[model samples]
Target: MTVMTTHLESETAEIKRRRDPFLIILWLVLVVFALLWVAPIVLIAFTALKSNAEIMATNAFTPPETVAWSNFSGAWERGNFATTFQNSVIITVIKVPLGLMFSAMAAYALARIKLRFGKLLLLFFLFGAMIPFQVMLAPIFTLVNGFGLIDTYPGVILPYLAFGVPYQVFILHGFFKAVPKELSEAALIDGASHLTVFRRIFLPISLPVLAALLILDFVSTWNEFAMALVLLQDRNMWTLPLGLMSFQGQFSTDYGQLNAAIAMTVFPAVVVYMIFQRYFVSGLTSGAVKG
Candidate 1:
């Protein structure tokens, strides 16, 4: 009877410990931070739905008196979003896959092959990634101009591909290295070529990382502004970021419409992240502590 009573008391104490006050406090702090983080997005959403007059009259946190659905239509038409959005899609479509293909091939070589100066080669690639894109802008523009490719998709795409490759290679290299050696070896022993092994074995296991990179690279390519601005002079060729800038300028006085344009600009990336966020999180952590 004493033992049973003691066990009951011990369980009660454990339950109390589990519900520690510090843990509750920590959760409350986290909740506050989460609200803080989401506040700007909430504000933007509210502002997008409001009219210019209402926005001016009320505080930023106030709900709109009436939702202005026309703001989106106005933004779309005035912003030339149809043309700019198409351009961005074309650039991202062409750039991301080519970049990933090249990066994957380079990473596969680095991971599976025993090349002389392999580490040096990797450092060289990493070094390129470390260099600021701003630093390369002048040279990139000059090169594109020399090619007579200004305002062309190729002009914008080439730079994006070049800038995208190094970081992608670094990520893929880590992922490829983490994959089991035995799988590749077994495939090789079955008379598979290096290309076959890479295509059949490595690529299959690397889907999470690839999906993560797909969304990330898509966002980067989609949001790229400086290089696109430098390379593309034609308004028709302007990507969404540039078009958004034009939209903002055109509707500078109209906060509702401007915010609507801002919302439209961010929507695609947000959707992409929402769709692939599971893979993104897993891919980032997969190679961090290789078992």
Candidate 2:
């Protein structure tokens, strides 16, 4: 009994020793990663505080003597961020939900229902995802213009939905397949219609996937420049990205103000990701593994 207990104690100590080194290495790696990720943002913040002269003279690594709270306000007003922000909000609000619903519905149909040409339909959507956005730009522009949608909100927004839906459908099909069939069947037996089952059972259980897609779509739509640039010719209808580009001129650049504007453009998306981060990871992993 004493010998056996001693051996067990020795094994436990060895396990701890092995785990301790791994833990230390993991912490060190995470610390390095965090610094690398954070360094650029920190530099941007620092530059935003400095005057143009200071920014040009000093090393970017150096900290400013004082925080320039006014830089944010100036960037907001001068950059026409108010209008840009509203444009982004309107586009995102309309596109994100529409994209999610359409994609989710398509994914559910593909994953759950038996239909003629279902595999072909899914393959078509996947093929759409593989097509480069640049290749379709000319055709999309012509389509939007033929409908007289150029320089219009719907022109930019509708094209976004059309392009974004395929990938969203692709991701969500995996998630839908991962959902247990019994729950859906049980709902059906309870006299729940397909719509009702989707609303109550599938949606509630699939919140993580939904949340993940929302963030992903929001980020993509918010940062989108090419389509917004080509479609929206009117300055009044400019998104944040298009508006930020206005700061650059042929003569000279305002480095301090430009960096501040760039930072402002990135801030909202970062806040959103931080808020929904947990669901984002869970949804992505769950879909990938289970599908």
lDDT of 2: 0.84
Deviation in Å, model 2, residue 267 alpha carbon: 0.5
**Cα lDDT of model 2 by residue, 1-291, tens digit:** 211222135877778756676556767877999999999989989988888778878899899876766777777878888999899889988999998999888888898888899999999998988887877788888999999999888999888998898888888888888778888998788888887887887778888889998899999999999888889888889999988887554212766777788898998899989999889888888775553
Error of 1 at 90 (Å): 1.0
**What tens digits encode model 1's per-residue C-alpha lDDT throughout 1-291?**
211222235877889857777667767877999999999999999999988888889999998889999889888998898999899889988998899899999999998999999999999998888888987788888999999999999998888888899988888898898777888898788888999888988888888889888888999998988998889999999999999988777778888888998999899999988999989878877753454
The lDDT values for all models are 0.87, 0.84
Provide the lDDT at 207 for model 1.
86
Measured with C-alpha atoms, the lDDT of residue 269 in candidate 2 is 92
Model 1 stretches with alpha carbons more than 4 Å out: 1-14, 288-291
Worst 10 contiguous positions by lDDT, candidate 2: 1-10
Clashing pairs in 1: none
Error of 2 at 143 (Å): 0.5
Off by over 4 Å in 2: 1-30, 250-252, 289-291
